[model samples]
Target: MNKKAIVTAGLAAALSIGAISTAQAASKEKCYGIAKAGQNDCANISGTHSCAGQSKTDNALDDWKAVKAGTCEEMGGYSKAQAKELLKKQKEMKG
Candidate 1:
């Protein structure tokens, strides 16, 4: 390919990778507890369990932890610390 074309392709590839990473991070889930894995609502977990949560599959730890910390508070009754601990226990139990 021409030099210009090669440069354009490289930039495109970089952008594509960035987009994929961002999307993957966003998909990392958070959970309320061990027994409740698939549900996404933070409120129910906090209301019933006193915890809010998030999850990341086996591969998404950083994103999962961070998102859960920020968003798990919506669970109606949990403090951020409780939500984080609940999520940590759930992850450990899953292992």
Candidate 2:
């Protein structure tokens, strides 16, 4: 293939990947206190780890998983606001 054609193809591929990632992110919601161990969607709030599948405990309020919006509560997950409340309660109990 010509050099120009190859570069065009590469650019198209990159744009396609970016669009797919955006769509996936749009469809997901950050749900807290529901992910199982090693099943989180991304890093914890404390910066203890990066990437998915790294949660140390199930239902850790600081950790979150991606779930479809409007379905997290059904799945026993907390919204960001609710999660903050839960975290506060936990800290109170511990202190």
Candidate 3:
């Protein structure tokens, strides 16, 4: 292919990748209180674990799993703000 065509193709590929990334990010949200035991997406806020599928407890406020945005509540998952509040309440109860 000609130099101009090659450059255009490269730019198009880069743009397509960027668009896909943005769309995925926009659609996913960090949801807490929905991950099953040993099924969390990543680290927990309490520093107990740092990998997916390592949680010992289900529906932990410190554990978060990614779910489709705008569907967390419907799925019985808590938003970040709500999770924080729940954590605070738990701490108060413990104290």
TM-score for all models, in order of appearance: 0.36, 0.83, 0.79
- Show where candidate 2 strays beyond 4 Å: 46-51
TM-score of 2: 0.83
Model 3 stretches with alpha carbons more than 4 Å out:
2-8
Give the per-residue lDDT of model 2 (tens digit) for 1-95. 99999999999999999999999889989998888999998887667888899988988887898888788889888888888888888889999
Off by over 4 Å in 1: 30-80, 84-95
For 1-95, candidate 1 gives per-residue lDDT tens digits of 89999999999999999999888768654533322342233344323423234432322212222243345445333444565676678889999
Whole-structure CA lDDT of model 1? 0.48
Best by lDDT: 3
User: Tens-digit lDDT track for model 3 on 1-95?
Assistant: 99999999999999999999999989999999999899999998778889999999889988999988899999988988888899999999999
Q: For model 3, where is the 10-residue window of minimal lDDT?
A: 42-51
